[model samples]
Target: RRKAKRGQPPKPTPPPPVPPIEADEQVFAARLRGALYFFSSAKNRNAFLAHPARYANAPPPTSFLPPTAALLGPEAQALPLARTLSRKLGLVVLSLDEAVKWVLQGASPLAEILRPIVESGTPVSPLHQVQALQLRVSSPDTLRRGWLLLGAPVDGKIAEIMRVCSVLPSRIFGICAQHADASIAGLEAALKEKRLSHRLAKIDSSRNPLAQQHEVERVLLPLLRLRQQAVAATAEGEAHTAEGLEVTDDDFVAKLNPKFGFYCPVTWLNERRLHHCGDGEAAVAKRCAAEYKGVYVCCASDKQLSAMLLRPEEVLAGPPLPSPLPTKETQQAAAYGVSPSLWAELSGHCPVTLARGPKLGDYASRALALKEGKKEFCVEYESKRYVMASAECMEEFLATPWKFSRLTLPSKLLPASDPLDVGELPTRGYSEQTLGDSLKAALTDLLTLERPKYPTLSCTETALKFVALHLKANNPNVRAPHLKHKYSSKLHDYTERCGLLDAIMRTARSNGEVAAHSTASAATDATEERDQGRPGPEGSEPDQTTATAAHSESAACKKASEAPMPDLATLFKAWDEAVAAGLDIH
Candidate 1:
């Protein structure tokens, strides 16, 4: 090493060369597939070599875990399960017993209080146990990676204490045995009493260790992925801010049209984040024109969001909307309805038939009179002319026009405007037309399966009812059946060929009955199980049967996990497929 000058730093010295080790004392190494791995002992190396295929394709162990999680149950069950989770998820396991022992070894006030009880081998109270565990987990080193608490009693007092102390785990899992011990039963009772069963997932102790691990992983992986994505999004947002790419107030204002404000259903649906439309009407119109389709406008006005599905080529050829967007109240008034003002505005010079006659009072008689073309009488009210069957009926209607003229608006004139509630707005990126077409296709397929002999009015009406029900299920705005009348017209000549409509109706009724019966039976079973003081299946609340209650939930979770995180295009595609397959849009 060279000596340095007084004001300068000393020169670094070279490390000494090491002697080569004997081959027998060298580290064990092997190549599996295309990757190299080193093992501390020959036993592990040999194990890997024995099943290279199993080890080769396995996911590399990850240290990622949920922010906080807890495991509760008997020592015999919880300890092993905690260890398994620790290995699987790279979590820090902090056992209550170990925490207690650590606390007793210290001079903390909680330790002083617990010392006598612990020494006597008496069970520590939930409060004291929580305090000890809190003391251990509060250490920065214990929570560097996320932690898994072990062997904590599932008591509300402990949970409440932990919450007050700001140390509550984000997730809790309880080990449940078919034949529970006294302590286990007590824990379950506390869970039930506190209504904390929903917060705790029961892990069946009878299943194999691998199955247990898989269940925990299944519950945890999605949450971990979601958390990771959220963190990544936050990081990206910060990065954008640092890079001066974040949207400023001025920038946001600049994106708006000043006259016709921007609205992008894509961002609103997929991310639940609002952004000004990047593409102007001209650009949108051009794109729609190129595709030979009209632009579907999603309008956002005060307290309401509405979507209008324009017919093809309407965007290019139709007149522009009026300046200054209309209020929801005005728009509702403008719609042709029972409002007399609306009738006066739209009646113009056209004449309409008084479908209901003041004297006839019956639908059959009115239809017969209309068929016979008895138009000798007429009355004018609210600038609208109504043709009547007889002079007496016209005079009677004129005497009290309001009473006899309470007519529903024709379906065609009732604007197919779907008003979406802010809370229940569509989060899936699907156009109204796409959804309707998919539904129509599915119904057509089902009708084909029925093999109808000839289309009948009854069949068309039944199909219309089905479509209305399906639409109402998806969108609360679709209250009336008139909006789907056009779809029924298209199918009117292709349904109810040979009593197929009756068969379809019967099947729908049967399905509804079966579903109702199953739900009632499950509820009864759950009530019986609770009354008997028996725990239900794993991952279910005391009032729920997992086999039934969890079926729909697990299916939804599976779809969410398997599907890619939705963007506009992907969500639209997924929604189209779901609708076409006749799956309920949960």
Candidate 2:
């Protein structure tokens, strides 16, 4: 190529070709003292640089490895660590289904039945699996063994099972739910392969095994910690076992790394020279030398880190747990962020319109309809009424009236309300009828299922939960207003009352006693007529029953009706039993 003119610099060479590796040459590589490099194209190098896990092999043919070798990578890297830890702890892992079948009376009976079903068409029912679990845990001997239950999931009923166990004050230590990034196609492929081959199928050769190990770690942590707790409680007189602390394995890894003092506190990546380590860094640099996979740090040396990485549950013994459940006090405090006022004062005697929120005419030229056309449902807050375009929106708006009341929804006012006049919109949305009638109509339409199949527990809490479950089932985003809202109180109280009557109605219907109750109600009406001696309407006359009939019937009814509504716990217990009884679990 000809050289450039004297003033101009020579043109740079074109991009270099990727250096192909020889038969014996390394395919990928990284450096500890400097940035990771690749002999392949820039894209390949960049990809590896971004995430070391992408290329981390379980064990290289040779001992040479980058400093960050034992990172959050190919899960196979964790197997040896897990095996070492399990051996140390002396624990046994129980496949939940096998354990269930073993625990159940007459194992042959279930196996013979399930085998044909499995061979024919239907997969083993998740419900049956749960039943097997119930049987397994019921036995006292199963609890004593240092064992773990894994792999039997009962569809959407894990919550229900936990609810049932909660009644027994379940001895569960911790649950680690691993939320991993895996494609649907990949999972389906694995399942299909397993079904077709009749052998073990690995979904993600890298991630799945690590996930299983982490789950065991989460459970083991609590089990070991609780034993310590029991020892301490012996002297302190306080509860020893800390139950129900769910944490992820990755989070545990992240937390433990801080104690190791090798990784940077801020970046959470392994550190370089003369940064945060101080005198400890120098001591590490001299006495300990990081070679290949082993990273020599002060708090934990290479071999120590390898062991800790597998089972760091000990360092996570006591408090400092993340994400505690919210309390009533905290909820009440949240409401106090803004001032509270009466419905009349806030609505200005206008119908509350969820379609056009409380802030309708404040900023824009006029209140306008949302992109979607208006829907239905009108409710009242105390005396002033509010209109929700949809049942769901109304639920959300009512759930926290105070928050919504001070603000407004985006809207365009009707032509009649032009000029954005002094007063809020007129009461056009809510009907002139009594608010109770309107609310009842809406609720009746809302509660789709029959009343009698309901749990025989407290109606108050159950009804509230049922309504929430029902609403969310219909619309995921449905919300319930704060307790302070009169609408909320009214809706909840109404639901409870309806639940009681509906329960009675359902019982009467099922028992074929509706005819008897009607006859009784009619006879009682005649007796009241006879006592009052009032003339029948228009020209009709009434028949009479025994004098003692009304007294006995009324008194018995009153006694039966006076039973208090059950609480939420009792309701869930009843629901669990009711659901379990109906499942096809052998």
Candidate 3:
């Protein structure tokens, strides 16, 4: 090789650093087809369309200023607005309806296939739609100027069309919401008669109405999707490729499904109305076009209407609720019911054990009320009107009800065979290998012998207290935590071993239930709110007869209240008298 001359050549400096190859001036055209090859001028465009393969290796055209001009709206707006958007925006508005009609008029081979489907409810397939759009937007000139795409990317096909195409609309210049749901009645009547197409065609307002360029400006300004900030940042910077974009169809579909879809014309009440759909009025107009016989249901709400009408396609996945079933501690004011928070609450543990009534030797698991005129007062410790009967002898019970109110009772118990089950007798349990037999013997000896002793006092007050005191005095070791009564250590050992606590409570609740039933009618008139521990109905005292009977009952109650503790033998004699008098006893 000869050495380079110093001044003449200077080694050519690597050919001025090879400039990057620019893409051909255009890659797409409007209403023209050439094997995806772009041309710079009309001469080159025609040359390429004539024989696309001759330029098979045509360098990809550099990205044109993206089609910043977008024309999207519902089908309703598309019919009237497409012509206007054409003149106003100076965009070659490719209305899908016009395109389909144009194709069918020429009876292109693809249009021949699309005609029947297009005439019927079904849209031309996504592929066919893309191809048709390709023919329109493929021209080299159209790609650079960026013509407006009007209403082909309808519901259920937007993503497929967008991803399959080599480009996307960079700017959304306008959105129009046709107030169709608001005027549903007219559409419904037209649809019901199947004369909607005829009526729409006949409508003078739709055909040659005064063009309100003002209307376009008004609607476009308020409904422009991108804010000023968003507009300042153009998406043109994104690299353009002749290759189709790859995206998961599912993600696109899911994001778009809720935002845009075909709504039935039928109303929520199922009235005859075609539901308007799509984001733009223009898009909605396309669907409503007579060429497409598709049916749609009305959207469920204004949100659905507005979102499909004007909202941009954005994903909004809401958070889920914690549970299907919610608990209620307090009733809402809307319920028009008493607040659950204000209502009386009950503890699960038995109220019988927490009551102080037992300490006074007056043990009953229920509260009996004494009626005086209109109001009733509880005889239990304090003013607690629950299932507790008072021990007239115990003052300690009034101070603390929770400590001794709860009562637990044995279940599945059988009564004793002998009539003298409650008599003071030491019935022994026989040990047995079988669990059932052993438990049975133990319960029987306990329940029949020392538990639920025969009533001994002449008065109800004396008898009830005496039984409570007797058991506690006899049984000491075991702590009946619910029972406020103190037991003697030595005297109560046998009582504790018998496990007769349940039997005693069982008998007490039984007698209380019986007493409740006997006077339930009178108590019904007292107050239903008594169950809520509220005061009885305010009213005049019962008539003279009621007052007389109450007086007599009061006298008996007073006498019982004043009675002293009676001997066990005297108490048993009183029980014998009650038995002879045909009163039930167990």
Most lDDT-accurate candidate: 1
- Model 2, 362-434: lDDT tens per residue? 5343344322212133333434434444545544444344444444433443334223432454554333332
Which pairs of residues collide in model 1? Answer: 452-497, 453-497, 453-498, 454-497
Candidate 2 global CA lDDT score: 0.39
lDDT of each: 0.51, 0.39, 0.39
CA displacement after TM-score superposition, residue 382 of candidate 3 (Å):
46
After superposition, the stretches of candidate 2 with alpha carbons farther than 4 Å from their true spots are 1-86, 103-123, 152-180, 183-586
Model 1, which residues run further than 4 Å from truth?
1-67, 106-124, 177-198, 238-586
RMSD of each: 38.0, 31.4, 30.6
Please give the ranking of all candidate structures by TM-score, highest first, separated by commas. Answer: 1, 3, 2
- Best TM-score goes to which candidate? 1
Cα lDDT over the full model 3: 0.39
lDDT of 1 by residue, 1-586 (tens): 2445456677555333222222444466776444577666778777777766666668865343245678876677777878988887778898777888888986888888999997898998767777888888866446556788876646656666775566666567777775664445655565556444444666788987778778788777666675554344344331101111111223334443232345433333433333333223332221111111111332323122211222222222333333222111223323434523233322321122444433445555443323111223434555444544344554444434555455643323323334455555464535443475657655665566453332223446656655554444445355567755645554453433345434544554566556655655655665577667775567445654454564564445445444433343554465568679998644
Off by over 4 Å in 3: 1-4, 7-40, 43-84, 101-112, 115-211, 221-586
**Model 1, C-alpha of 257: deviation from truth (Å):** 26
